[model samples]
Target: MPAAGRLLAERHKDHRKRHPLLPAEYEDEQLAVVEVTALWESESASGAVLLEDSELTGYVLGAPKPSPVWGPNLWVEAAGQAVREPEHIRDLYAAAAAKWVDDGRTVQYVVVPDDADLLDAWFRSGFGAQHAHAVRPAPTTRLEPPAGLKVRRALRDDIAVLAELDLVLPKYQSRSPVFSAGELPTLEEALADWEESIDDQDYATFVAEYDGRVIGMSVGCSVEKSSAHSGLARPDNAGFLGYAAVLPEARGHGAGRALGEAVMQWSADTGYTAVVADWRVTNLLASRTWPRLGFQQTFHRLHRAIGY
Candidate 1:
């Protein structure tokens, strides 16, 4: 990529007004523009495209490499007036898919149904929104590390133990809501990736050891771009407080609080103006901890099921 010619701040502002789902911040400015006008860059890219040459009625965003994202790992996002020419659309999509297949990413994320031009075009285009995920903002406001638990920076030796601990403690809780549940089939794969994440420069992994036992753990991954209300730009180790988990026995011992506060202090000491974390509206811990840490729900994105 030579250079992303345009400034994202301009596009970001416009997208915010039009599509609230678009993240308010851009971690990589060049990446944002490259992603935005992927339709125009299709010739240079290996990915297929869904385009409209006449009337310039439609637009698509595609990438040679698929980003790690939740919504079908999307690289193409497009919506526009009808692309009525019809003949070119299929080739466009096929080209894009071929590009993605051959590209290293080995995945293609596209917006579904191609509602603007043709439904079958979308079906033929080979794109589906099988399961949708939302990228809501995580809390960036710092909360002090709680007392009573010893907090310290993580080490490589700690990863194996952390990996096993992470597998269960804060495991997906949907099934019980009151108890921990099964790991998704792909969870181990995600865990494999976290091996690299344990050493990522953007984050800090801190553990709270109670009586020499690592009862609780908290991980903070920094965000280059953030949507916190503070509107500060480019804070280092601007921690994204995640992987906050506590053992069952340590549940009420203020372990979570201690781990959380430690991360906050580190964020403060490291000179970040804020940190970010999130919880489902239904999660009880979020209901308590967020408020206790002076966090407030800035916005709500409601989920709805359709075509059932």
Candidate 2:
């Protein structure tokens, strides 16, 4: 475990050397040690450790997700892997995949740092980019919304519209190329969620209105509140832009970009230094919008499915 932690620390150090904006706190080996130990001790844990000359060179571990959305899925979480050499990752994954497939976990996902060599190695192991987690410095000024468009905090009266806009993302993902099979939330579910979050101290919801009709919405919260991002290294006092969607008719009017800027401005006003967001890599609109908004990729979720 200690050797694996050391390897992870070294890898993070190298990543920081290339991308200095990444959080520096993770360079501590003990943090990796604790993280690796917890994953190793998890009930569903399955893994492989590579040893050369009685010395640990690399390791890979994963556990099956209970979520029905991901049937027979094995998730190699952010801290689930480390290696002394980028090429060593292929060998570690080869060993881990055999055990995972034999156990009937045919769909696998791994969260890997945004290192070119590391990503290439995983690609060679038959994984392709599936999702991305990214961050950008909070903006001091909000971008101006398009003419006749008003952006403001969401209200109870906007719940129906907010709920309607929320479905835009998942519905789009279900179409060609993306093919995200996760069940879509009903309007009732989305309305209930917004009602609970509307006045919550931890959440901030924004809406874009055109001709007094809500056409887009966005939500922001602390990074600590996001399970997908909390496990990874992030800038101190980072906020998360958790959700954003605009109606199809509002697409070219700059509603999406305006909502993003509003979220960044909110993060800045709320004392956050940076803001993080994630999206499916194959979601064409999001894949292009996020990077253009100055969010640099920090990690990639690579996926591979066997026999299905």
For all predicted structures, in order, the TM-scores are 0.49, 0.95
Give the TM-score (vs. native) of candidate 1: 0.49
Write down the lDDT of every candidate, Cα atoms only: 0.49, 0.87
Worst 10 residues of 2 by lDDT: 227-236
Question: Scored by Cα lDDT, where does model 2 land?
Answer: 0.87
RMSD of each: 9.5, 1.5
* Candidate 2 structure quality by residue, lDDT tens digits, 162-212: 889989999999997899998888989988988887788788989988888
Q: Which stretches of candidate 1 lie over 4 Å from their true place?
A: 1-147, 178-197, 225-238
**lDDT digits (tens) for residues 102-199 of candidate 1:** 54444544433212344455555544333222222233554544556677887776765566567544454544453423334345664686677778
Deviation (Å) of 227 in candidate 1: 11
